[model samples]
Target chain A: MKATVHVTLKPGVLDPQGQTIQRASEAIGFARIADVRQGKFFEVELSDDGDLEAARAELERFARDVLANPVIEDYRVEFLSDLPAASEQE
Target chain B: MKATVHVTLKPGVLDPQGQTIQRASEAIGFARIADVRQGKFFEVELSDDGDLEAARAELERFARDVLANPVIEDYRVEFLSDLPAASEQE
Candidate 1:
């Protein structure tokens, strides 16, 4: 099984990187860019025996435990289908 | 409505940041870490009239056009419900 984890700042929290992106967007003429928050993405491959729910729980734990500061950040989990190329090797 | 965009390097493509994170992970005692790929996450607010599919398409275009280099990266899009506090304003 494979999964992706996305981590971002919770709303109402200040994000300096997001503000920089917004300013850059305006400078580039994309005036419609209302807001921007920056975060991290992780792709993880797990044992085949793991199901999506299990993967999600594990990934969430990883996020809160190591990947993010839970007090200020939020995360999303996604389970991905192993591509044929990836499956062929295992 | 709100959405998040996750941009990641496709498999087989090199990710230096991921390697750095992996080293950090191992330094912290996570020996089980198999692979790591780093990417970016974005939080965006869209007009309520927008549907998920529409939001996804727009986000994909944005990713390909600016957020990522399509040659070596792939992106996933997620649609999120506007928080009650955000909705209460309008």
Candidate 2:
């Protein structure tokens, strides 16, 4: 199973990179871009250990402890079984 | 409408950050991680302009020209209509 984690800054946090992108987009003649926020996307490949529930919990902890900095960033993990769509459940 | 762009390095490209994360995971006692790949995720918020098809085309070009390094990276643009599900049909 593959776990995909998206780590994004919480709203109200300043994102300089996103600001640069917003300005860059405008400079490049693209319009209607109200805002842009950048983040980290990670695809973690794990050998199937069968217990998805346990794996999900483990991955969540891993994501929290290692992948994202909980103080300013938030992360969401989605499980993609066998490389197909990782049925993202909110 | 909001367009999401995920820019990922093409296969065969070296990802040192991912390698670091993989090593760190192992050192931290996290197991079953066969591989880990990292990428950039961008959320571009655009004010509605009505033509979804045209917007998609524009966003596609924007992604290709700006967000991705065609030499070594690949990007996919997903349109999220009205902040809900971006009806990612591909």
Candidate 3:
């Protein structure tokens, strides 16, 4: 099974890389863009032994402890097969 | 309006950061994990004047030209409000 973790800067946190991208976008003529926040995404492939509940829990723990910095970022985990349609959730 | 860009390394690209994370996961006792690939996610906020089609096209261009390194990475752009549910797509 596969899982994806999204780690994003907490709202109000300063992000220099995001700022750089925002500026670059403006420079490239995308003046309508207002802001940009950058984050990390991790795709993990795990050996699925059919215990999905346990796998989901482990993946969430991995996301919280290993993939995200709590002081500045927030993260969410989703099983690849469980991901919703592209028009429902962020 | 808000959009997200996910930039990931192409398959077969050497990812030292991913290796480090995989090793760290093993050290933390997640032995079932087989591999991990790390990527970047960007959340962009734009001034929406009700033209979503043009906005999406511009966002895609920004993702391709500014947010991703095409030589080594692949990227996808999704409008936050248009993102699918957690189980439909990855």
Cα lDDT of candidate 3 equals 0.85
- TM-scores for all candidates: the values are 0.65, 0.86, 0.85
What's the CA RMSD of model 3 in angstroms?
6.4
List, for all models, the DockQ compared with the true complex. Answer: 0.32, 0.74, 0.71
**Tens-digit per-residue lDDT, A16-88, candidate 1:** 9878876776677544456777888787655554344444555567667777788998877766874454345
* lDDT tens digits by residue: candidate 3, B36-58: 99999999998877666667778
TM-score of chain A of each: 0.72, 0.83, 0.83
Between candidates 2 and 3, the one scoring higher on DockQ is 2
Candidate 2, true inter-chain contacts retained: 0.86
Error of 3 at B90 (Å): 24
**Which of 1 and 2 is the better model by lDDT?**
2
Model 1, position A55, has a per-residue lDDT of 47
lDDT of each: 0.68, 0.83, 0.85
Write down the TM-score for model 2: 0.86
Docking class of 1: acceptable
Candidate 3 lDDT over residue span A13-77, tens digit each: 99999999888789889977889999999999988776677677788888888889999999998
How far residue A38's Cα lies from its native spot in candidate 2, in Å, is 0.1
Candidate 2 local lDDT, B25-45, one digit each (tens): 989888876678999999998
